[model samples]
Target chain A: MIDPLSIFLLLLSASTPILFAALGELIVERAGVLNLGVEGMMITGALAGFAVAYVSGSPFLGFAAAATGGAAVSLLFAVLTQFLLANQVASGLALTLFGLGLAALFGKPFEGVKAPPMIPGPFRINWIVWLGLVMVPLIWWFLNRSRGGLILRGVGENHDAAHALGYNVRLVRIGAIAFGGAMAGIGGAFISIATVLQWTEGMTAGAGWIALAIVVFSNWTATGVLVGAWLFGGVTVLQLRLQAAGVKVPVQLLSMAPYLATIIVLVLISARQKFSRRAGGAAPGSLGQNFHALR
Target chain B: MIQLVPRSEVSTLWQFLTPVLAVLATMVAGGLLFWVMGYDPVAAIKTIFWDPLFGMASSYSRPQLLVKAAPLILIASGLAIGFRAGIWNIGAEGQYIIGAICGAAVALAAYPSEGMWIFPAMVVAGAAGGWAWGMIPATLRNWFGASEILVSLMLVYVAQRVAAWMAFGPMKNPEGFGFPGSRNLQQYPSASNPELIAGTGTHWGVVAAAVAVLATWFLMSRHIRGFHIRTAGLAPRAARFAGVKPETLVAFCLGLSGALAGMAGLFEVAGPAGQITDKIGVGYGFTAIIVAFLGRLHPVGILLAGLLLALTYIGGELAQLMLNLPAATVQVFQGMMLFFLLGFDLLTRFKIQRRVVA
Candidate 1:
């Protein structure tokens, strides 16, 4: 018989990476800029964090390094797409490709190295898991009640109007994007520093994209992100369990559970949102468009 | 009051010239990158751009160029069609894998038998495999409004693992002492995708790619469906009013793109690749996306773009061999292409204006 508590622990561990990335992306979209470079940033973080943790033998510091690395790269994206008014999608794709190449280059020497031990959690759970749980409510309260939060929502709602009201639209978006990058970095670090406890090529395994989808599935809400992460975590853990049980299904087929589940849930939520629009709110206006300030 | 000057419209000449211009610009950018990497930039560029076609080793490398370009062109042509309509199918790599597996399975079913029907059956199976893989996302999008991009891209990893499992397990050559691959298709002449004329870099894939270019050109320029795709991309609402069903277009684009990608994989397995192995997928799917965009999502343009990209692959390899450049230099070039393409494409969509707030 499968242990429910073990499953819960596995779910918590799996959800940490998604939680960190989705939360960051949520804050970004809330600021009216759609940056699709989360995948790039996360991978970059994975390499940087892994390198740090591997060399220094401290996973915590590795995570800190990852967040800083991810944020720094994200700032480059911010400068090009935000300040230079470059197309968001293209810039994001460039970032992903650039990040992948750069990671491959920097991580050539560090390939196949064992990662340092993870910072232990309460009762067998890691601290990142606890941090993920804490971040959900933290993000919720900040989005709803904080002073800077209102300014971000204002920009997302209408950049022109927000600027008309003398709010620093560019500054707010850049900060949000940078924060999103840091969060994604932390998410990437979780993979190397916590879950795998090892570094490998293309190690993020599309987790960043999954996190992006989760943000949409959650309808840009915090608690929804937590729920979405758990759901994905469950699917992933269930697949691994099925494999261990020597099920008749092909391991390849079983491995598809997470991706298939993501597609299904994403479609389900999209359908719900589409149908619920009569009562449901719309996606923020001015989303994904570059804003130009004529000075 | 602040004065704003309207930017001039880019002419038709610039429209066609931009891709060529982008290539030159990429060379300059790539050169600078090479210079930073400590290699003589000029030598690296020549070894990459010129050596594969006209260098002393051109005889060997030149044939390889067509061999590589054939599948990329064939697959990218299909993707370019959908991309033009704003339908994104990023799962070509998955489709390619499925196609190779299914096609090779067909050939294996006729194992050691001199069956003339084997090659034809494999071709159909390959196309079917790709079409089926593509329909997963297309059907979901049609039924439940899913994001095809995510579904399609996710399927790639799934397909990859499936390929790995097959190579190591059920599909493993029992006679070959625990090897993680299947019987070589090249050994079965009846099942093989033979070159039309040997030593000319000709294959079924090259023929298919050329045919695809012509077909797509006709479809996009003359067909009503083409009009719908273009209209839908330009204005989805207007296209809807014009009686184009968004769901139907999504399925058609995804399905067709998938079929072509599958065909490319099949041809590779039956011809150049010669087996169903773990290395069946070699980043062609992702690279094809770049080809679709670089070609500006036009069929004829994709043909040129495919060859150009194929050149880089061969050239990058040449550079690596001759100049000790990194293998990822090609990817860096591709990144620069998209970076420049996106930046330049802005001219087609929006006119720039300068103003000062008083």
Candidate 2:
């Protein structure tokens, strides 16, 4: 049987990639523009980070490359939805398809190749896990305490009002979108560099969508994102542990727990979103609505 | 020196030309991508577009077009309806898996029993599975304003694992030597959906795809419900004011899409695939999204668009076998189609003009 402490640590590590992506998307949603391309971005980051790490023999360089790759794809989204007034949802979806395709094509050459050795970490916990723990509080501070954070919340609450106040909604949004993409990239890199430790086609395998749900499961708060990631991580991590323990429950049924948890969490959050008009925890006012200023 | 004049009517020619131009643009951009990948761009493009009908390998790959297109058209046609209504059902993949699971479950339960009712019962169960899976988001969204897109999508992973479990567990063929998968449905005569036209690759699913197109066309063009769907999508406030109950519309759109998607899964399991396993839902749910978008969400467009996308699948395989190109290039090509389509679609809503400084 696996040690409980190691299993707990393993779950924390597994949760990091999803945590990074969810937190990033949370910030983006907070700014009123929904980017559904996090899956594409994550995959792109996975490939980019993996490739750079392989070539340069530096995991840090890989992370940087992943961020660049994610941001680059996000730039297309920013231009369309922010500048061209395209529908945020559609543009984001298109970006995902495009990114997935690009990654697949790019990844073909790297198929069967192994990633470099992982960057060593403190106490059997890697750098990403430590950073992910730090990022949760850091993101909390950035969103709630900082001036830029206030502006971001303002835009999400009311883009037109934010614009009327000369907050440069487009510029702030572009920055937020890029930041979100970079974070998603880091989350993706965690998979390639730290977890799976190899470049496989479609390796991220629905992690991006899980991250997206984490934002909702977290109730759109940075702290909630960490808890949701860890919560999901615990469920997923538990499944693997159950499989190892040779539990009689079919691994298939065991696997259902994590997704079931996600659905349950979503149900709870949705129930709140439904009833909360009376209780008042609303999605940011301008979420999923594109802003077109004719100034 | 250009004279400043009032903008006249937008030409009808632009509308017809835009979608075509986007397709052509995807091809050109796709060729550039091929070039970057160090493959012969022209040859790659030829395989994707020209090979299905006129290329040297046409005779061999021609039939697979129908085989591949059948499921895509079936799924995309359903997805297009919800997409048109702005319901955002992204979990068709999950629906597909659950439908297969339900259908396969019915078959597994009736193993070694030869009955006429068994197959039909499986079909009904398949649809129920899909409908139930789709209702997760539909009910959630209708009751509580959750994003259906995320909920629907998250379920795909869950469905996949469930599929893996079933294939490796109780659903496994009892008599067979402990292999993960159950008895191949292909070997079972009563449950199998065989090719009606033999080499033409025409199966029950293809007929279903045809039926879907006709039904969708009739529904969208001649039905009052369809008008409500369009109105709700284009102008939600106007739709609500027009007395089109928003919740009902959401439920109907999701339910309809789910049923059609479910039927597609049933047909696929009984036909070309011939079995339900972890590999059953092979990106069709997601790929169908591209088909829906590529076809501009029109049933007729989907018919032609489905074949076109199917051509890429066939050609992608050919490219892989003949030219050593990766299988993923076709997806890249598909992605380019959306990029070009959205970029071209910009013309429908806006036009650019230059302002000269005095």
Summed over model 1, clashes come to 2
Q: What is the C-alpha lDDT profile of model 1 across B217-281, one tens digit per residue?
A: 99899999999988998789999998999988998999998999999999999998888788889
Judge the docking of candidate 2 as incorrect, acceptable, medium or high: medium
Which candidate number has the best TM-score? 2
Query: How good is the docking of model 2, as DockQ?
Result: 0.58
Candidate 1 error regions (>4 Å): A1-6, A83-87, A121-124, A279-282, A292-295, B1-11, B350-358
Worst 10 residues of 1 chain B by lDDT: B1-10
DockQ of each: 0.51, 0.58
Q: Can you write out model 2's per-residue Cα lDDT over B1-358, one digit (the tens) per residue?
A: 3222223554556556666887899888888878986889999888778877788878778888998898889888888888887889988988888888888788878887888887788878888888888888888887777778988887888888888988887688887797777678877877877889868989878998999999998888899998988888888899999999988987887777777778778888887787777888888888888788778888988888899889989988888888998888888888777767776665666555565557
Comparing only chain B with the true structure, the TM-scores of all models are: 0.95, 0.93
Which stretches of candidate 2 lie above 4 Å from their native place?
A1-7, A278-280, B1-15, B112-118, B356-358
Give the alpha-carbon lDDT of every model. 0.84, 0.84
| Real A-B contacts recovered, model 2 | 0.64
Q: After superposition, how far is residue A72 of candidate 2 from its true place, in Å?
A: 1.6
How displaced is residue A184 in candidate 1, in Å?
1.6
